[model samples]
Target: MRIRLQRDIDRLKKQVVSLATLVEERFRLAIRAVECRDADLARKVIIGDAEIDQKEVDIEEECLKILALHQPVADHLRYIISVLKLNNDLERIGDLAVNIAQKAEVVASKLELPIPFDYVTMSQRAGEMLEESLNSLVNLDLHLAYRVCAQDDEVDFMKSAMQLQFAEEIRKAKEEHIEPLIHLFLISRHLERIADHATNIAEDVIYMITGEIHRHKGFEYHHSEE
Candidate 1:
């Protein structure tokens, strides 16, 4: 029974990793669409969301089956529960990527205007957080998980600064630029939310490893410059 349960758990981990890879690729494409203002790329991301949704559902079903069949306990149980939570976070990140893609479509249609926000940098940081969170989960690296949680605040600061930049731009914007400006603001917002989801994943990793809850408390682990 133990060996079978471990085998099933290993299989579930692989499935979750596959989903993570898909979601991360979609997010990167969404960021590219934002940078290039490519509606074609944005459309691809939007269309790809259905596959992600289906995969998320499939993973949830597998997790349920594992729980019912094996009745995982202790650390094994924690790992399963953490995967379930992080799985949902990953799906939400995919949705946010689609949101960014949809906003990119709107921003693409308009005349190019000066964007005061450093949106590309913010997107890159958010992407890194997502990558690190997934790495933590895949490798069970406690430090990587904690590092991801620490970086969330940086993304949050950029998002707040973006709002200020948008508000200032709004004052001087001509009528035609208003719509694109709004979309840019929303894209930044989505990126910040993506960072939030990434943080949630990191927290789940910590819980899975330590068997201790660390939501809203990961900052305590941010010691050292490593």
Candidate 2:
């Protein structure tokens, strides 16, 4: 029973990693679509969301099956629980990618305008956070997980600044450009949400490793660094 349980746990890890990679690719594509205002790329990201949804469902079912069949305890149980929560976060990130893609589509349909903020930089930072969070899970590195949590503050700040800039742009822009600028602002908002989900994943990794709940405490520590 022990060997079988370990095998199932290994399989679950691989599945979660696969899902993470897929979501990351979708997010990167969405960012590119926004940068280039490419409707076709945005459409591809939107279409790929269904596959992500199905994979999320499959992972959830597998986690439930392992709990029911093996009844893991201690660290093993924590690992399973962490995977379940991480799985949900990855799915939500995938959904946010689709949301950004939808915004990209809308922006692509409108006239090109100068964005008042640096969206590419914001997207890159969020993408790095997601990648590092997944790396922490793969290596079970506690420090790397903490670093991912710390980076969330930077992303949040960028989003807040972008919102202020958007408000100013909306007030000054012609009526024809207002809608596209709003969509651009929403894309930044979606990227911020992606960073948030990545932070959640990092917190779950810390929980899985030390079995300590650090969701709030981690935020406090990271916030102090700012």
TM-score of each: 0.95, 0.95
The clash numbers for all candidates, in the given order, read: 0, 0
Candidate 2 Cα RMSD after full superposition onto the native fold (Å): 2.4
How close to the true structure is residue 122 of candidate 1, measured as C-alpha lDDT?
Answer: 93
Question: Stretches of candidate 1 above 4 Å error?
Answer: 218-226
Give the lDDT of residue 24 in candidate 1: 99
User: Cα miss at 16, model 2 (Å)?
Assistant: 0.5
lDDT of 2 by residue, 66-123 (tens): 9999999999999999999999999999999999999989887664586678987999
At residue 1, what lDDT does model 2 achieve? 100
lDDT of 1 by residue, 44-78 (tens): 99999999999999899998999999999999899
Count of backbone collisions in candidate 1: 0
Measured with C-alpha atoms, the lDDT of residue 114 in candidate 2 is 66
| Model 2 lDDT, residue 225, Cα | 22
